[model samples]
Target: MYAYQCIYLADVYLCEAGKLLVVPMDGSHWFTMRSVVEKLIERGHELVVVMPEVSWQLGQSLNCTVKSYKTSYTLEDIDRAMKDFAGTHWTVRDDNMVSLWMGSGYNFFELVFSHCRSLFNDKKLVEYLKESSFDAVFVEPFDMCGLIVAKYLSLPSVVFTRAVFCHYLREATQCPNPLSYVPLNFVSSSDVMTFKERVWNHITHFQERLFCHHFFKSVLDFASEVFPEPVTLYDLFSHTSIWLIRTDFVFDYPKPVMPNMVYVGGINCHGGKPLSKATKPGSRTQHGYDPLT
Candidate 1:
């Protein structure tokens, strides 16, 4: 019997035209973004993804038309920076649990904002945006800098949360913050933080907020002088509509939320299909053997 080899390929489908461009920050972006894009495409939307070089490479391989932004520093650089500042110092010894101290130094938050601005103002990107028009833009809040671009284009924007929903941002929106009364990571879950982590989280939260305010102030102040918007950039973030949080209703915590603030927990996995039968089970050889003979 002659053995035959066969290969299978899925049809290439162009994402339907007219949704908007999606600007995802990094590989650590919300995992649900891909699913959301697919659903939008199915509903007749074309997606142009603006991503950093690393994300572009990955997104393009997955068939997305990617806009690449160049960055000088690597993830390792940020990691080292964090370790030196917020992380455990090897110089210290004799501790059951190493306590991290808040140090006074160059504001790491401002440094991070500067890095974000560089990506935002990439010349090629600005030119592209000047020519291209998008219907709307979506971004994760942890990756907040995308909002700058959205604001520049005067386009509507939505924020998706990758971590616990931010109470401060919600309060800024005039919505009741569910986590305001509850401590950070205090939701009813197996993954809730231990006592030490909670304490550290609180400490770090204050430090981060202080620097974040300063960072936002400097950026917004400069942008106010330059941009045509009547409201300050910081003010713009407060009034944004439709904040989608990843917390489930099962968490049993609810606050006086604004109509715009929606609990979109696990909405990322919505409308996704599993791998096809042919893509699983049998090995490639089992499906059809290759005979070199």
Candidate 2:
């Protein structure tokens, strides 16, 4: 077994001269940017963050430049899109919640088209990159559009995956796609959700597999149309110069590793900031909330 123990996102805030573009998939995980950009500044690099308008507060707090973009769909929007598409077989509970087949809390078709749209949305992101002239693009895994943009620009790209090795990265590295390799029964997270959440996510995982099989071919076609040389999704991901996994190697199973992929450890390592006595969960009376929140 390949065992990696210390998994933390370092908060050194290195500063380099070259511009680095950082984007996240979710608003809650915005701390990754805080830690990374701080490190970049400390090392002397210019830092910029791209995210949805919802995170404007985080942008203000960091005192960094931010470019807001549409990164997600609301639950209402998802329902509307599903209804618009034909040939989709969906089962919603009486409460209207869907099953999360893979425990990521996405519907099967949602996973597929969500990625497909991300792949297609590179044109917009490419324009931004050209305008900004960023040296590197570090993206959260959920921001698949960043991957597409990075590939288009041929810029050095780094993806921060919250989970262990996922299918896309596995395939890119010429390793067996983890989706195909791992048993369907496997649970990647420590806690399980209610049945309502499971029902929706399970269906989503199934849809994702079907979409990858069906829509990826068209993505290849589009790539050929856009580039002088033909490229596939696998080619795009393979072109990624660095893979930043948010995990340690220890708990993961043994597999053939690649040279470009680096185990950057976890997102929790922010150098050494001693947790205050009041910072503990139940000790609210001491520190009055670390204020980082």
Candidate 3:
């Protein structure tokens, strides 16, 4: 009986295996996405990861094909840019919140735009990817490359994300976000709102729309250059077939979720080594060498 079950499972796994194209976000965002990648590889799927040449963790020890594209910025340049952006918050104090965020956010946003331009300009990589004939695109929608690629190739897209920046997920998915009960993350700190809080939420939603128009100007322009028809960031995101939300429902507040959204929280914790007593926080260490050291 056990032998027959093994043979049946093997057949099912063989049938399910497919070629997967991965366009992951650089830095810590890649951490959770890697777990999904590792699982797919174990399931006998062929995986291709596309990334910038100078990314930190994307280059290390992947048993799959990787296509690294050149960028305008070097690793050192990126480091300096990061420090420059982070240092702004430490040095300056502005009373006006709008100006504070706008100044820093816009400057930081320029790097992303530059990277996007660099990717698009690499004619060879774009052409190769178009002809690769992959099954689907698994993307971290933090950067819109994966979303655009999926649409360009007309391949089904799966989004592996924590949250879409600027709370764009609500608009993109056409998911109803009733401000009275459903808290706008940018507008409110708490989910449960008072009458006054609810009223402020509605007012702030309008203000956010106005801000986002200016904030996403580059994205709108980029979309026009990429595709013939007019496309917005929300439109690209709305094309996603599956939304793998990295959030635990037990710890998270009650919120509306769409039919396609799956909360597979703690994905980063998958395949991790068991924490030894010494390695665990606040753990008693008998040996002289402690994990804290």
Superposed Cα deviation of residue 195, candidate 2 (Å):
30
Per-residue lDDT, model 1, residue 29, is 56
Model 3, position 164: C-alpha lDDT score: 74
Off by over 4 Å in 1: 1-17, 54-60, 82-112, 163-167, 177-211, 215-233, 268-293
Q: What TM-score does candidate 1 get on C-alpha atoms?
A: 0.61
TM-score pick, better of 1 and 2? 1
Tens-place lDDT per residue, model 2, 54-142, is: 33235655556766545356546544544444223244332222232322233423433354354346567547657887778877654
Comparing 2 and 3 on lDDT, the stronger one: 3
lDDT of 1: 0.55
Alpha-carbon runs more than 4 Å astray in model 3? 1-14, 88-101, 270-293
- Clash number for every model? 0, 47, 0
The models' CA-based lDDT, in order, is 0.55, 0.55, 0.75
Q: What would the C-alpha RMSD of candidate 3 be, to one decimal place?
A: 5.6
lDDT of 3 by residue, 76-163 (tens): 8777666776777776554333554577656665665567667778999999898888888998887678888888889889988887
Best by lDDT: 3
